[model samples]
Target: MVVAGRIHRRHFIIGAAGTAGAVVAIGANGVDAPALAQQTTEPQNGKALPEVVSWKDPDAVIVHTELTVETKRDKIGTSGITPSTELYLRNNLPSPSEEAVANRDSWEVSFEGVQNERTMTVGDLKRLGIETVAAVLQCSGNGRALFDHEASGTQWSTGAAGNLIWSGVPVRTVVEALGGVAAGRAFMTSTGGESLPEGIDPQTVIVERSIPADIAMERAILAWEMNGQPVPLAHGGPLRVVIPGFYGINNVKYVKKVAFTETESDAAIQRTGYRVRPVGVSGAPDQPSMWEMKVKSWVTHPLVDQQSGRIQIFGVAFGGNSAVQRVEVSTDGGQSWREANFVGPDLGSYAWRPFVLPVDLSPGTYTITSRATDASGNVQEEVTEPNHRGYDYSGWRRLAVDVTVT
Candidate 1:
């Protein structure tokens, strides 16, 4: 279906989700998203926010303090899908002017990685094909706060991730329509539309990333719509690249360029930034680029004191690049584990599922944490290794918090 105007939220949820347990599907299928506020008083560096991300729920999302803003963990509710208004914001450069995206049909994105090296407008791309995918968009530095060393970037906790529906033209459809990918190409590099300021090194601050070609061809999309609405400006509007099973950085916002290259782009974001290295070592191309995500899960409910009997433990879990097999809850801090049943519909392999384990408790302080297992048999790491950038801190123990049941 070509995106003519206002795509309904219901179509995507019912069509995209595969039923899991008896629990009803939340997110798009559950209920209408909360309305966005016209005003905000959230502070950033003692002053008011630079700009009002009017589309975002001011009360639900946090601003400043962490690179951009992040969502409150509790606001990242049990709903399998995150509403656009409630999604977190993380950006390297500022969003383009409203004029740039005012006429969505006029927006042009050049395709230079294949035989049909031509530029196509957003309207042109929309006519190609329509597909929907549910995947988790998580910051590569999501668990940075959990790391022992002070990570340089955002101090994101669990709120940095969200499972949402993306409706767009399949990258494969575009590639095939444009005569397929060029030979000798190993990476698919996508560029954001955010304008760069004069004088600064473009390479240092620009947002461009190149991912493995095979993965891009198989799972990437040029998303013009997000969470059932035209992609909002705050969350990358007009169009953005959606690469499932990859970190949030890989999903370039305000995307206007797609290229096939034999080698990874020398773009700083792809070259030195977002690289994982030792605590003392500087990021280099040789070090791993924070691309594929690791299997992980963390408790969202019971963050505070709870009642003694019949309490349900709730959290979100996902298999980074595979299906989540199971999630184990450890009340004794990882000493022992019990399987938890999934409460929402299985949103495919890449998206996270809400899980629950109802347990009766007596008055006492109990530490709680959850571990996830992916279809590949990869279990969530017990502790994160020390790194200079403090990326991918999957240690379940750090997520452990005490809650007194009375």
Candidate 2:
């Protein structure tokens, strides 16, 4: 049930309570035995095989059947905040070593291109101040699974997203301590700490991206905590950037460096990746980079496989850099729409708002859809244009469910 404009926290407790035993068993030695077993599988030819660890959550609804993980829509509202365990995982590279994340307090983030260039340990950051914010962290390719044409990346559906509460100091606070951005720097580039395979050239690998200086000095956060707990390694543990109202890619995880630069980073990930282009468009320069998230909504209840009757339809709506002004639900495709009642208080401009609509229907097949309008007057589109990499799709999402009303 929804309350105070947020999913009731009780729902998450109950859902997690069911798995508490398993969590304890697997976490006995503070190790993921299943993951370790998978990594230790032997090859028939007796050759040493590279370790393969699966980051997929067994309880989550499988969307891409690969690195891209997504939560079950029906389970989304169980908690006001997505539980860290239930949260989706998206990694462009293999998970870093535990040894690297063990000494959380010792993890240092280097700052450059400022008056006082130096490295500050996580402990040093804590002494400055602490702030908290509730925001949504969603993959740019979240709805790629629904694209008419096959997409090359993770085919995530509705579950590749979550609303989370992050605790840390504002990135601007740290920047100010470094004597602020250098005179000519217009961008702040962040890099992750993951190590690559032996043969790969470090230069060819692009794990860093840059954001405009304005954004960095605004709502960006250097978060070390999630849901009141230390951020786990699987979720960018030691330190990560949390840029509210922006796509998850912009919130680089396991951050190691923050560089202020006069020009955008030339890193391949910064220049060539995360661009939205038409099917045949090949170059990054020809496409626009995804920054601010677009206004979007999702219908999470009466899931695609749910039986319908007297149902209460509910889901989430979020606007990038603006408040969600209103939400509309359509029971008959896009033919008709009715305003949905929003539940919960407005967390912030960057947080997702929950909306509910109660409906009575007869036995039949139905197509349900949701659309949102931001306070800035931006409305969600009925259809999203197909792009080459399937990035930044904020189109009205449709849910088809069969009903056997008795």
Angstrom error of the Cα, residue 319, model 2: value is 0.9
Q: How big is the RMSD of model 2?
A: 8.3
Candidate 1: tens digits of C-alpha lDDT, residues 217-307: 9999999888777877767888999999999999999888999999998989999988988898987999999999999998876666655
In the predicted model 1, the residue pairs found to clash are none
Q: lDDT at 150 for candidate 2? A: 81
Candidate 1 — which residues are off by over 4 angstroms?
A: 1-34, 39-52, 65-67
Per-residue lDDT of candidate 2, residues 307-373 (tens digit): 3355777778988778889999987666799999887777888888888898987766566778999
State each model's C-alpha RMSD to the native. Answer: 9.7, 8.3
Model 2 worst lDDT run, 10 consecutive residues: 1-10
Model 1, residue 371: distance off in Å is 0.6
Clashes of 2: 5
- Per-prediction tally of clashes: 0, 5
What lDDT score is found at residue 235 in candidate 1? 74
